[model samples]
Target: MPLVNRDQKHYPGLAQTTNYNLSSFKAAEIITRDVVVIGGGSAGTYSAIAIKDKGKSVVFVEIKNRLRSRTETYKDPKSGRGIDIGVIVWYVTPRVGSEPNTTGAVFDLKTGRGLNAPPPNQTAIGIAFQIYTQQLLKYPELDAGMFLPDPAPDDLVMPFGQFASKYGIEAALPTMYSFGAGVGDILATPTVEVMRAWGLSLISSLQGGFLTTARHNNSELYGKAQTELLAAKSLLLRSRVVYTERSTSGVRLVVKTPTGNKLIKAKRLLITIPPKVEILKRFNLTTQETSVFKKFLNTGYYTSVVKNTGLPDTLSVTNFSPDSPYGIPKMPAVYTIGSSVYTPGLKLAFYGAPLTNVTSSLPAKTVKDAIIASIKRQQTANPANPTSFNQTTPTFAEYHSHAPFWLQAKAVDIKAGFYKKLYALQGIRSTFWTGGAWRAQDSSDIWRFTAEQVLPKVLKGL
Candidate 1:
């Protein structure tokens, strides 16, 4: 059982020795551990357990009071059905006989349900895959071992738009970009970045197929993680790392929690959160680290459930203009929209526009309103059956911002080995890093990489 310093919350098997206050330690509560992990998302939670399994103590800190960051459950009173609000599906390819099946499917991790994917442009996907494979062969560093590079690959850079054109798969851009808001703008995105994200090989057959949320919704992943990680000595909920400092010997983090301030001392630190400039500023990063971090471009992706969208249930919304490259026909950009999101009236929307188009700093309501407006415009803008009709203004049922997602740099930065320098920071000043930026986006891939590659490095520091 792990030992907790405070008694504000209770875990099933942990010992909470809060009755005895250590006033002698300092003005604030001080707790020491072998490792400290920041962020409670898939990578951090998995890292904590993997490290603990290796016989090291860990302190898990999360700004939110939950283990899952984007996964949530939305319950509708009318139908009494709970639908997933975030982190829904895992893509996978099944097998036929002894060979792999070209067709893909979406598997629900929690429920073990498999939904067959629409027939993809195998010709287009094939060309892209072959090109990426040849690129990987040329530069082994670009290989996505399990999910992400153990150390990020450097100098492997090209825009997805360029890669597609080079391979005559520009026609398949629509199919490739169907992943919705999780992957921001596909055309302008980095080629290696896109390959790792929803790469044909990556999602083809890692675990035989994709996985999704159960009836309980997407929170199942986090719930399971929280249950497993409860044994960690220090699991600080509703906490934020207000200040941080590192030395050759160890790291010191000042955390603000619901209970009070906590001074956390640990031999190593694992940061799984997106390395935002504003957030990293608190960590006291070196000039080199700051320069590398600042180069990363963050996207604006938002997820939400809306009610009373005036558009017909038959139509879905996607954003495109006449100037869209390669003559790809306009299609629904919002991805999947289930009538059963929470109830029949509620529809889920994954809105992703460029940060330049929809700034990250915008409030959730503001973004939601913009999405509703876009939906309304899309309903009437179709040239095939253009009709101007005023429908009831849609309102948000719930909102979640998965923004600052897909952190990437320009082609020039990649050629400069920015990722190599970023990974070289590992064990420097006793700090390590992981997250979507470090690798692919899928939870399964992140967990696999964490177990196989990241934990071993973390163990070395411990």
Candidate 2:
């Protein structure tokens, strides 16, 4: 098993470039590698390490300087004893595990209803025990993070539909989770994502977060993976493929560097790139890959935004999700804005979401002011003091003047063929396959899949 550093949080980033004429630049170095992996996020890092373990030289590249896209911090103001933003981490559980006292309820997920038919007494605590045990397996420090007597040791206290009532609607749930009170879309995801978001949200006030070491950040894990690949001497930082020419001998890859350009002659290639068709088309992909790349060009994704609202000037509600907004389509219940995020009087990370054409798909805004207006509508106008709505935190997303409302805002979500074609592109050049959106979600999961499928296949004939 790949042992990731438990000390840090792995962050990813994607940036746009100013120099479009890079493709015309003169060349410099000549290098060779068994494999070349694009992207430096969780999957990219792990894939590089796994390939290196196969005894092949490799090269890894990134469009941005940093690994992660977003960072979290604290909100201003203070409560009597809680946090600055009122943010909390939440875990899912049945009735029995709440605390020193209080019964828990059990809802069968398969059936999606209360399961009180057969047994005389099947408490929710039974579930609490199962979750705690799972934690024990995932983390070595479980003993330090959990407490048995507390019923809510692993879950967040929820009063869903808070945003709905605040808006004087039948329910305010849509704005709370889907519209995200100006955060990211939290709809149509796997169960794990929902659980993780909820669990972290539940404990925001009490235990802080499922946080890693501050210094290491999550990059440490990827950094360690990079280290494992050191034997390959294949890492190419601050470099990019300017042009690729398929030659009679082999594939010739010309990459641009600060000092000069680099030419690499390779027997085979392995590429893991983003599903953005426009972005992928820039690279000199093979004919087969080019055809697939063109298809991806039409796809888009949603950029996420997370923010804090509903706070007194004197105290901010840190790490908290709004009551579930009733009617919104793609809002998330909770977002990981930050943890223990109290900085005298400033909120740290607030809102982020994928930006896409989905806004057009829904009955919202397609223009700027209209989008912001629609997004602002998603949140209640500050209940305690009606004027408080005007005093909300200024998030990065707001400054960009980008898509504000995230009801299916486009950024993360993509078309179906995008992933399938991306993965199939690997076969265009043997030993080359794309992962991430083409394969899986989690970094570790991507690594496992790559190692199982690609490695042995690459080694077979060679």
Candidate 3:
């Protein structure tokens, strides 16, 4: 509760960086910036750019060698067209000609064209969503925002399957399951937390099909940010925050780069990555800070592009057992939730779980094998197609693991205003937080929240 201005950890000749031994560190490599934004994803990149635009100095740091999430495009041998294996689209406001259909089909923002296929049957889904609307007044903070709302304790702790059955809304499960893609089986997630994580914007996008993708790929957006940040001399790709020194005056981070270790001293620290307790423990966390971070649950997601799948290019695959026809059946996770061809014979696969598990931690070959097995199973199970995979395994073209993501706190912690405490830690030790954990998962929303909410506090302190 004390203002950081009273703390003297930053005072001249005070204790050296307490988390890691500075005696063995090279002080000569120290670099200073007004802000050090970690995790060069949507929020981190946006924050770095925004800070620089404000006429302040900043350095962007990311563990990946590239500025954005790993995106690769494979060229189809026969068609010579690119197949994006990573990020695919952007969620933009619906254009004038675009309109939602009776079936909740999506329309492209630029072209204003609805998808060729109509939306799945969702009449029952609409009835289920009424529960959220009915409870809106109880949580006003979530009503007018793009971010997810803190759930009522009961909804927060209750799993999705139970929540759906309790309200006689089991029909909505499959419709909402895709929203839980890469997170895990929605049936296991806290019902409201899933709603909060995706927020209304994404739901609207799905229902109306207003989501837009970059011309090149999802990486294009990040590429744009990277170019801009590079022009500003604020990007540090392939950087790891090895140690941190926090005090009343500023935050100093020891970042390991491809070249060597460099010290980054900044007035504010904006961390956009999923704050895993193990990762956070690296910083000089007080017991209270550690405890709060430890309360969060982390998810694992792995996405990839593949070739030689040996399946017909025209066939679209969705993973489900033979028994479940209308709902997302309970499983460890949505193993290869869906697969679509980007070009002839080249495809993309997305796999993950709400909890940190081997599905995400396993080697790329193992995951690829599983996807092939699932595809073979689906093909064999289909009475209409009855096609065989020829016992051929798919070859991986690109692999990117966004493991230990979607950090969430317990319902009790959320109701206790965990975010307020999260924000309170902002200026404490001159560190701040952002990204999906603090805001919405979508890039558009994360950028908006960083610009509107996070940067102001950072600037005020600066």
What lDDT score goes with residue 274 in model 2? 53
- Give the poorly placed runs of model 3, Cα more than 4 Å off: 1-28, 70-82, 95-120, 136-138, 143-153, 214-216, 322-326, 333-342, 354-360, 379-391, 412-420
CA lDDT scores, all candidates in order? 0.63, 0.38, 0.61
| C-alpha-based local distance difference test score of model 1 | 0.63
Number of the top lDDT candidate = 1
lDDT of 2 at 107: 25
Q: Write the per-residue lDDT of candidate 2 for residues 1-462, one digit (tens) a residue.
A: 111223121212112221233234334356766666666655566666766666777677655554432121122224322221211212223222111211222222222222343332224333432443354344322222111122332222122232223223322122224223333444333222223223333333223323333231343454566555544556666566655554423455655545555666666655665544344443445666656544421112222223443322233222222222222333321122222222222222333334342321222123223323322432343334453434444333222221222111111212222333444555454436545444333233345556766656554554
| Candidate topping TM-score | 3
Each prediction's RMSD over C-alphas, in Å, is: 8.9, 14.2, 8.2
Residues 77-105, candidate 1, lDDT per residue (tens digit)?
Answer: 67777767777665454422121122232
Of the two candidates 1 and 3, the one with more favorable TM-score, higher being better, is 3
**Deviation from truth (RMSD, Å), model 1:** 8.9
lDDT of 3: 0.61
**Candidate 1 Cα deviation (angstroms), residue 389:** 8.8
* Candidate order by decreasing TM-score: 3, 1, 2
* TM-score for candidate 1: 0.78
